[model samples]
Target: MSLAPRVVIVHRTTEYEELVARHGTHGQAAFFLGSRGRDIEEVAERHRRTRQALAEVSAAVPLTWRQARVERADLDRFLFAPEDVVAVVGQDGLVANVAKYLAGQPVLGFDTDPGRNPGVLVRHRPGAAPALFPSVHARNTGADELTMVEAVADDTQRLVALNEIYLGAVGHQTARYRLGLEGDGGVVEAQASSGVLVGTGTGATGWLRSVWQERGSALRLPHPSEERLLWFVREAWPSPATGTSLVGGELAGPAGLRLTVESERLTVFGDGMDTDAVELTWGQTVRVGVCGERLRLVG
Candidate 1:
């Protein structure tokens, strides 16, 4: 017989937990915070709410179904099965954090603190999981197939993200690369700047929005469900050796952006997770485009 479908619950370490870990005890953490004119109760309250939501979601899993729980730090090591249903119990960012690891499995996002979170991805409450479980398991529930972005190096090293992928220097130093748009008679430019950012419509509201707002309507951002990707070369510096004409544009249909590494080394990371990034050496090339995988988020 086939195994029961698994429900994977995902969460992150709370601020309270981090504080305690850093200070060695709750009392010490509280004292450290109090010394800086902050209150520990606020952090503790958030921790309590997150814990309660996790417990409630765990209890809501059907008795006959298999279940698993994982923290954000451990996601890189966790293997997800094809027949799994993911329950993200935290904020909307947590949902994004887990998106790159999944492959079309239904993701039900639960907002532990609705008042604090934006409720974009994690729109449901813990109490709603019980009523939604049956429909989700049957694959009859409504879902949004959010578009995602991907970057693949010449060596076949790849990275994916729900929000955005950044290719830049390992530190704060300027990055050097040759940027090109792949298509008929595409243009290429040798540039020195902060870095490059490629993002999806689902990310239009986050980091990409900040860059868009500053550029003032040069390009239109795509919708969350749209199969489109946007690219921007951050703070492109112009000089005799470097041109800035090919700075930003959109990738629709089969169009893609390519980057040839000119610096000693560059780092590529997705969704702001720099620790887990792909490193590129000089003369190496990487391509950024819309990923074939989509995030099937349960609403």
Candidate 2:
């Protein structure tokens, strides 16, 4: 007989009871967002009646409680479990780590946009392509560690991205970057500009397009360039734009095109996470993509 799948329902500490009652997508489920002294009683009262039902479903309970980002070792233990399904129920924020845990497994994540409140669904698949970003690194994860980057990349699957992969100067002046397209045989000129926006189709109208839409004045981009998600730094906005251009002054230091080949040090960020201090002189390259793999967020 085939054993039933176990689902690890990770959420804010408060939602434990309700999620367990619904038995979301599996017989066994774990909640990995608990606090040490968190008042479960307080959560029960505010969330809903499901907590009360959770008390009754103790028999079907495969409940695994979690401590939120308490430590690297702790997260490794909770996520690397050999469970059948790891249903990460939350915004797109925590999906990356969850992806790290259930590498090469049937992964799902709940996503939220400007219109959609946070919801849950599948985020990855065993054979599905990885998302459009540089590979995930298992950093500082103790001495003996195996990162998922290699395992996931081995699978031949396209990735899905929900927004823009952006990098802005953090502590110093805004830097500059040279742009060159990857696929075509010809090399394009290195346009002098501040940043880049490499995103997926879903991300197009949102984060990627905002710089144009908010400014209400996009540069006269050609048809092919606009269709593709890759963009270069051409315009500058000193203040926080509704969507168009970098809010230059608000971001790094005096924003006179932070991205530059001369300075040669770029703070490379992907999916809103700052990762490396890039050396531009060597043209150090990092692979980032807004991959194609979004799922239906069932209510």
Model 1 C-alpha lDDT per residue in residues 24-108, reported as the tens digit of each score: 9999999999999999999999999999999999999999999999999999999999999999999898888999999999999
Show model 1 residue runs off by greater than 4 Å: none
Candidate 2 ranges with C-alpha deviation above 4 Å: 1-4, 12-84, 96-104, 107-162, 183-185, 215-262, 275-282, 287-299
lDDT string, candidate 2, 158-203, tens digits: 2223344454344545544433333424333333345555543334
Error of 2 at 231 (Å): 3.3
Compared with the true structure, model 2 gives a TM-score of 0.44
In model 1, which range of ten residues has the least summed lDDT? 180-189
Using lDDT as the measure, which candidate wins?
1
In model 1, residue pairs whose N, Cα or C atoms come closer than 3 Å (at least 3 residues apart or on different chains), thus clashing, are: none
Question: What's the lDDT for all of these models?
Answer: 0.93, 0.35
Model 1, C-alpha of 207: deviation from truth (Å): 0.4
Residue 163 in model 2: shift from native, Å? 2.8
Q: Candidate 1, residue 141: CA error in Å?
A: 0.4
